[model samples]
Target: MAPGVNDAIRQLILNGRLNATSVMMPAAYIGADEVDALEMLNAGTTRAAIGLHVTLTAPFKPMSNGFAPLRGGAFPPINDMMRLAMTRRLDIELLTIEIATQLQAFLSAFGHMPDFVDGHQHVHLLPQVRNAFLRVVSEIAPNAWVRQCGRVRAGRALHDPKSLVLDVLSLGFKSQAARHGLTTNPAFAGAYAFTPKARFSRIFPRFLRGLPDGGLIMCHPGFVDSALQSLDPVTTLREHEFAFFNSDAFLHVLAESGVTLAQPSGEARGAA
Candidate 1:
């Protein structure tokens, strides 16, 4: 999550529309008061779990600068990094250091380990990055879980090819997590191609219906701002999501699908 990412999400958690969010530690938008308030609101309810959104791509600076793969002190684009990994061109030692540094940043900012961890563009599931992630978690945050992207069948209106590619990339993630004694969400949804004209109202209901019980659905719902637009290409879609989630339509769909929001297991739990 970045600066404007939290506003609508905070409302969703409080209003019972969303239950989880991942935080980007290095983003300039992090506010101590906001995070503290969120923790307070979730104290007993466990309506949401704050997770670390590990960033290993550009438009932001790396916590450590000496990493060999970094371009101008920031990570290169996702595909380029993947190419480097596939060709054995990345520095595994530097990758290890960067991963450790981000985890440490998470701890420092949150004052405790994050409830879970995942990558910005699913980089955590990549070749060398996966090894570095597992190693760091095993040493520093052995009990905290991780997010694993899983494939969803293509529905009429919701077809995100990139999400499918990511799911295929992370095919053995659950088994690998189990091998390392780390828990993970069983299923995943909420991937989109970020088309400006896409109607979330049509797409979201289908998504909820297709989702399995205890499955996890990631979402981005925020008021768009210059900062957000500058950082992300999926700007308008976020507002669309925010509006859909807060509407009565969303509630009706959840009830129709027998989907009740619950915090992922392994955290504090009570009435939300």
Candidate 2:
């Protein structure tokens, strides 16, 4: 996705079709045109929170130069880090350097501090990542909010096996965030495993009804242009996601469900 797609999503959110968007900053589209993102933000044309969509994946391409500790020169870059971390192969110094690099990149690209922090593919929640992530969060803004995927309300039946993994990961994440004084949404969304062509109108609203106010909803919306596809494999399916999320149905459901849209405002949890 490029400036065109991001602008479209910003419009959709302004029109109240979607709630939030998590972006990959160093991934060209957002990074290539940080000025555009900042302009939209400064104008308040988009109200969704802009968090650090930390990239540890996409190895063959590293995003920044200043941050160290991450291993580059491989495909799906962060995969190496994850593999090492899981198998006890990660170097603590490298991990620290890489995260710091990402942080510096975010500030440079966006030209201000992030409103909250979350990982691309939930990387920030990983065991090794959580430790490094917190230190950065505490240092960067100290009071800016952070995101934890934990779902607090009980008695909800989780269907997918992947959800089970998320639940376990989120549990630990929530604890770490609090220890660092990072505020998080009571719920987090935006995990669509199936193809984006799959109908999301019903699915999205059901999830919205469950959305706790003063929380966050993560969404990936982009056109499946050839350029994007070459850069990222799932660009084809995510194109549908862009259109669907920006649709009239997406907005209607939220209204019907009485969901409120809010953006975090530093050290505060909002409901509206």
Candidate 3:
């Protein structure tokens, strides 16, 4: 979304610790230059998996038009979107068009299908939204895996309200994906309070605790720039996460946890 984020991801991929990332097609900085740079970076050797980050929330304009629910020419906030989805008030047809448009943008820019697909704010898990999302992915990029936020193991963070809520919403998601002939990650982690005082170095190890082999851990590591600050409240923490991941301490933590970085397999039973 921002140049800082692009730089951070490029560095992390070069660092050889990160494996996959998703792109926001509607982001302001995502244009010809950025796409060219990313393509060049991904040309040879073992490039990181790139996927579409389906966006249907604030801070971004819709790629497709005729959305009756948009507020001020922008997608509504996550909470409002959730409410609309839960109440069956969302315009599913319009949502599907928007998603398809975004996917088309990704395909147009990358000249290939995404390795996977997921929602920007986990919006793919919402009721009305999930149907539109899955349908679009199945039709446009059937080979891509989808993200499901169900945790397979009970860890200390299991009781955390955010984790519990996501788990509850994720019930029957895997089966839904199967019905659509799409695969999903087995488990998920990496939910935390993005407070200004939070230390990612201390909080990240806990995300690995009890995480299954195929579990996916979400993260947002980036440099702080004016563009990023304008779009997100999760500002400083991105720098913190980037620092931790870029440091030798990250390698030490992985070694201590007996974890090795690897790409998710094609059989849909592993992490990416």
- Over 76-134, each residue of candidate 1 has an lDDT whose tens digit, in order, gives 88888889877778877788888889888878767888778888878888877787787
Ordered by TM-score, highest first, the candidates read 3, 1, 2
lDDT of 3 by residue, 1-272 (tens): 78998889888977876877889998998889887877675666646777899999997889887876888999999999989988999988999999999999999998988888988989999998999999999998999999998775665464588888788778866778899999888778888877777889998888778777767889999999999989988877888888999999999998999887776333334463
Candidate 3 to truth, TM: 0.95
Candidate 1 Cα misplacement greater than 4 A, ranges: 152-160, 264-272
The per-model lDDT (C-alpha) reads 0.75, 0.63, 0.84
Q: What clash pairs does model 3 have?
A: none
In model 3, how large is the Cα lDDT of residue 120? 91
Ranking by lDDT: 3, 1, 2
Which portions of model 3 miss their true places by more than 4 Å?
156-159, 264-272
**TM-scores vs. true structure, each candidate:** 0.90, 0.83, 0.95
Model 2 residue 137 lDDT score: 80
The runs of at least 3 residues in candidate 2 whose Cα sits more than 4 Å from the true structure, single-residue gaps closed, are 1-4, 44-46, 63-72, 75-81, 152-157, 263-272
Ten-residue stretch with the least lDDT total in model 1: 263-272
| Candidate with the larger lDDT of 2 and 3 | 3
Worst 10 residues of 2 by lDDT: 263-272
lDDT, candidate 2, 201-245, per-residue tens: 545654564566675556566665656656556664555666776
